[model samples]
Target: MMKKTDGEKNKFSLWLLAWPIFIEQFLQFLLGSVDTLMVSKISDNAVAVVGFSNQLFNALMTLFATVASGAGIVIAQKIGSRKDEEARTVAIIAFKVTTWIGVFLSILLIAIPAPIATMLQMPEELLPLAKIYISIVGGGMILTAMMSVLGTAIRNTGNTKGPMMIAVGMNIVHIILNYCFIFGAFGFPQWGLTGVAISTVTSRLLATVVLFLMFLGTFERKMGMKDFSIFDRKLFKEILTIGWPLGVNSGSWVFSQLAIFSFLAILGSSELAARTYMSTLESFCFLLGFSLALAAQIQIAHLYGAGKIKEAYKAVYRVLAIGLPLVIVNAFILVLFGGNVLSLFTKDQEILTICASLLWMNLLLQPGKMINMALGNSLNAVGDTRYTMIVSLIFMWLIATGCSYLYGVHLGWGIIAIYACMIVDEYIRGVLSFVRWRGRKYLRMKETELERESTKFTESFASPSM
Candidate 1:
C-alpha cells in the first residue's frame, strides 16, 4: 500500500503520510481553540493565564522534544540502514530518558511556576490562576514528553495513522473533560482554569499510554528490556547527538514567543485575550503546512540517511509544491474573514477592534511561517541543524523581537503594530528559507564528510539516521 516510489515522484504516498499528520495537528489545534473558548468564558485573565502557562509548558516540553528529535533521527537512520534491532534499542532509550527528564522537569515547573510567571509580569489577580494552571499541567508533563518520543518514533517509521486517530480521540476526550471540570458538571467541582489544565493532563496521559503500547505491538523493531538497560551509554550518546541541537533550536526560538506573550500581557487583559484567540485560530490554518513540513522531514531523513541524495532533494520540492498552495488558501481565508473570526472569540469591543486589524497580517504570516517551518524541519531532519540555529537566532530573536518591542512597547503602536512587525519578520525568514532550500544548502551540508553517511537511500527503500 505504501510504495517506495510511485511514478518516481511518490507524490501521492508523500501526501498520504502528510495528510494524517494534518488531521493530527488539526485535532490538536482544535484543543487550543477549546482552551480559548472555555477560558475566555471565565475571564480575559483566564485566557492570559492559559496562554502564559502554555508557553512555559512548551518550553518544558522542549527539553524532552530535543532528545526525542534525536531519537527520531536515529530511528530514521536505523530504519533506512535496515538496522531494525538498533532502532528499537534507540526508541527504548529515548523513551526512558525522556520519562526521567519529564519527572525532574515537572518538579522544577511546579515549584517555580510563580517565579516564572512573575518574571513574565503576571498580573496579581491572575497570578493565582496561573500557578494552579501550571501546577496541574506540569504534573502531567512527563506523559506529554514520553508521547512525543514514542510518537516521533512511530512517525519516523511511516506509521502516521495511529497518532492522528489517537489525537482525534484525545481531543474529544479533552473537550468532554473540559466541560465537566470547567463547569463542574456531573458532580465535579468547578475549577475553572485549573480544570482545563486537569483535562489536558488526563488526555495526554491517555494518548501516551496508548502510543507506548502501540510501540511494542506494531513495530518490527520492538521495545524490550534490552533497550532500557541503563548501561547502554553509547545509545544515549547517539540519541543526544541528534536531539540536543533540535532541543536548543526549539527552546531558543520558542522562548521568543514567551517574550512576546509576556509583552501582550502587559498591554492589558483584553489585548492578551485577543492575541490568545488569534494564535488559536491561526493554528487551524497553518497546521496543514506544519503537517507537510513534518512529513517532509521524515521522508527527507529517510532518503538522506539511506544515501539517496537526489531523492531527498526531489522529495522536499514535492512537499513545497503541495504545502504552499494550501498555505495560500488558508491565509486568504484569514484575510477575508479576519473580523468575523475575531468575533467568535469575544464581545469585548476593545479586543475586537485590535484583533480585526491583526488578522490581516495572518495572510503574510501563514505563508512565511509555512516556508520557514518546512525548510527548517527538513534541514534538521537531515542533520543540517546548525543552519537553523543561526537563522532562527537572527530572525526570531533579533528582527522579530526588536520590531515587536519597537512597535508594542517602545513606539506604543499597540498589538496590531506588534503583529505587523511579526508578519514582516515571518516574511523575511520565510524568504530566507526558500532561498536556502532552492540553493540546496541543506542538501549539500548533509552531503558533507562527517554527516553524509547519515542519509542513505536506494531502489527498494532507504534508512534514515539513528
Candidate 2:
C-alpha cells in the first residue's frame, strides 16, 4: 500500500546509504584521531591517558547502542511494513530511555572516576590526567548517548545525509575549539587534556541538539507531549529483546579490548601508546567495511520486514563481495603507507617500530574482520542477535582476552603475540557467523513467527468480544 516514491526512499542501496555513513563515521573517527594527534604533541603519556579514558567511555556508549540498535532495527522494519505511527512511537521511546540511562551514567562517572580508574588497573603516573579526562568527558556521556540514538533513528529512516552533515559541522567546530583550548589560542586558557575533553563534550552537545531537531522533522504529523506520554510496553519489550544481546555483544568486544589494553599497560607505556596509535590507523580500514555492513543491515532489515527473505539473503553476499575487496585494498594501502601515517602521531622510533609491525599483521586481520562484520551484522539485521552475541561472548573472552593475557603478559611474548591472538579470534567468529547465515535458519524462524502472529490476530477478530 506504500507509494512508489516512498518505497524507493526506503529501499536499501549500499552506496546511497553507505557513503554518507562512511563519511560521517570517518569524521567521527577524525574527531578522536585529532584529539590523539594533538595530545601526542603534548606527550605520549597524555596520548595514553586519552586512549584509556575513551575506551571506558566507548564501553559506556555500548549501553546506549543497545537501545539505538533495537530502535533502528524495529523502525526499519516498521517503515518497511508501512507502520509509520508505530515507528515514530519506537523513536520516542528510544530517545526517552537513552536520556534517562545517559543521565544516570554521566552522574556515576563524574562522581567516582578515580575508583573506576583504579579498578581498571590504570598506570599510577597516568591517573591524574586520566581522572580529569574521565570526569569531564565521561560526565557528558548524556550528550553522546542522545547523539547516538538520534543518529541511529535518522539513519534507519534512510536520511543518512542529515547526520553526515551534522558530523561535518561538528568536526569543524571541534577542531577549532581544540586549537583554542589546548594551546590557549585566541585568549583561551591552556587546559591541556581538560581542554580536549571540554571541546569534545561541547561539540557533542551541539550535534545532539541539531540531531533532535532533525528527528522531529522525520515524521509528517506534529509529535506533541501526548505522543511521548503514551508507553507502548510491547514495543519496548521488543526493543529490549533485540537490543540487550547487541549490548552484551558490544560490551564483550569492548571488555576484551580493555583486557588487551590492560595487558599492554603491563608491558609499559610504549606498548600502550603503540596500541592507541595503531587503533586510530586501523579504524581507517575497518570503518569502510563497518559502514558498508551498517548499510546492508538497514537494507536487510527492510527486506526481512517485507518478507523478502531471498533478497535479504542475497544482499549480504553482495555486501560481502563489495566489502571484502574494498577492505582488503584499504588494509594493504595502510600496510604500505602505515609508517608515514603513524609518523603523524608519534616520532619516537620505538612506538613507530611497534606500529609498523602491527600494520603488516593487520593485512591478515582486516579481511577476517570484514567477513565477521558483513555477515554478523547481516544476521543481526534479521534479528538473529542471540547467535552473534553468544558467539562473540564465547570467543572474545576466551580467545581474544584470555590468549592476549596468556601470550602477551603471562608468556612474555609481547604485543605482537596479542595481535596474533586477535587475528585468530576474528577468523573463528567470522567462520561461525558465515555458517549461521548460510544455514537459512533465521529466515525460517522469522517466517514462523510472522505466521503465528497473523494467526493470533485472526483468532482475536474471529472470537466473540469479551
Candidate 3:
C-alpha cells in the first residue's frame, strides 16, 4: 500500500509537469491551425506555401534547439544534484549562445529568402508567397529562440505553468491580430501571408519578453547576468557534447519528413494540402505523447542525479504506460471526426476522403509512435542520446525515407504507403529504445557522466583555477 501510494504521488507529479506543457503545445498547434485555416481562405496554394515555409523555419531552428536540449539536460541534472548555482550558469550560457545563433539565422534567412524557398522545392506558383512569409518571420527568429530557451529553463525548474500561461496569452493575441490583418478587418490592410508572418513574429516576441521577466521573478535559483558571464569553457563543451547528437536526431527527422514531403509534392498541390491538413490533426496525438514524455524525461534526470536509478527505471515505465494509451485515445477521436476537421481547412471532397482514410491508419501508427517518443525522451535525459540518435538516423534515412521513395513514388502506392513506412520506422526504433532502457547500460552511462561532472565541479571549487 505504501508503494502504491508513492507511485500515485509520482504519477501526480508527472501530470503536474505535463498538463501545462500539453496546454502550451495545444495552443501552439491552434496558432498554426488558425494560420493554416485562414491561409486556406486565400488559396490552397497559400496553405501549402505557408506549410512549406514553416517546415523550413523549424528545420533551421533545429540547430539552436540543440543548445536548448543540451541546456535542459545539464540544468535538470545539476539542480537534481543540489547544484543550483551550476544549473543557473547553464541556463544563462544557453540563453546567450542561442540568442546569438538566432540573430545570425534571422539575418541569413531574410537576406536569402529565395534560396530557402528553392531548397524546399516550393511549387512555382507558391514560391513568391513562401518567400514573403519566410522573409518576415525570419527576422524575428531571435525572439522565438529566446522564448524556447526560457520555456525550457523554466520547465526544468518545475514551473511549467508559467510558460503555459504566457503561451495562452500570446496565442490569443496572435489569433486576434491574424484576423484583423489577414482579412483587412477593422480597417487593417489585407496583407494576406505577409499579415500572417507579422502576427506570428509579434506574438513570439511578446511571449519571449514576458517569459524572460517571469524567469527572473519566479525561479527559486535567482539568476543574475553575472551567472551568465563567467563562461566556463569546460561546461560549454560538455553542453555541446550532449547537445549535438540531439540536434542530429532532430535534423534527421526534419530532413526525412522533408523527403516525404517532396514525394507528396510530386503528386500535386491538392495532395500536399491534404497532407498539411492531416498533419495538423495528427499533431494533437503527438502532443499527448510528447508532453508526457518531456515530463518523464525531467523526472528521470532528477532521479538519476539523486542516485535513484531504480526509481528512474520505474518512472520510465510509468510514463510509457500512461502516455501510450492517451495517444491511442487521441488517435481514435481523430479518426471519428477527421472528416469534419478536414472540412475546416478546405471544401475539396477528394482531399477530405484521403485525410479521413489516413486518420484510420493513425489508430495503428500512433501507439508505436508514442512508445518511441516516450523512451527517446527518457534516453536523452539520461545522457544516452547517442544510441537514440544513431538509431533514428539509420532507420529514418534507410528504412523510413528509403522505403517512402520506393513505395510512395516508384510503386505509386500514394501517401498512405509513405505513412506505413513511417509507422514501420517508429516501431523499429521504439522497440530498440525500450530494449536499451530495459538494460542497465543507460543507467551505468548516466552514473559515469554524473560522477565525472560532480568531480569536475568539486575540483573547480577546491582549486579556484580560472
Per TM-score, the best of the predicted structures is: 2
TM-score of 2: 0.95
Each prediction's RMSD to truth: 5.0, 2.7, 4.8
Candidate 1 regions with alpha-carbon error over 4 angstroms: 1-12, 230-232, 439-466
lDDT of 3 at 228: 59
Clashing pairs in 2: none
Report the CA-based lDDT of candidate 3 relative to the real structure.
0.84
Q: Which regions of candidate 2 are displaced past 4 Å?
A: 1-11, 448-466
After superposition, the stretches of candidate 3 with alpha carbons farther than 4 Å from their true spots are: 1-12, 218-221, 445-466
Rank by TM-score, highest first: 2, 3, 1
lDDT per model vs. reference: 0.78, 0.88, 0.84
TM-score: the better of candidates 2 and 3? 2
Angstrom error at residue 168, model 1: 1.6
Ten consecutive residues with minimal summed lDDT in candidate 2? Answer: 1-10
Candidate 2, position 351, lDDT: 93
Per-residue lDDT of 199-241 in model 2, one digit per residue for the tens? 9899988999999889887864657766767679999998998
Candidate 2 positional error at 154, Å: 1.1
Q: Model 1 over residues 203-298: C-alpha lDDT tens digits?
A: 888988888888885557455655566435787788887778788888876788888887787777877778777888788677888888888888
User: In model 3, where is the ten-residue run with the lowest total lDDT?
Assistant: 4-13
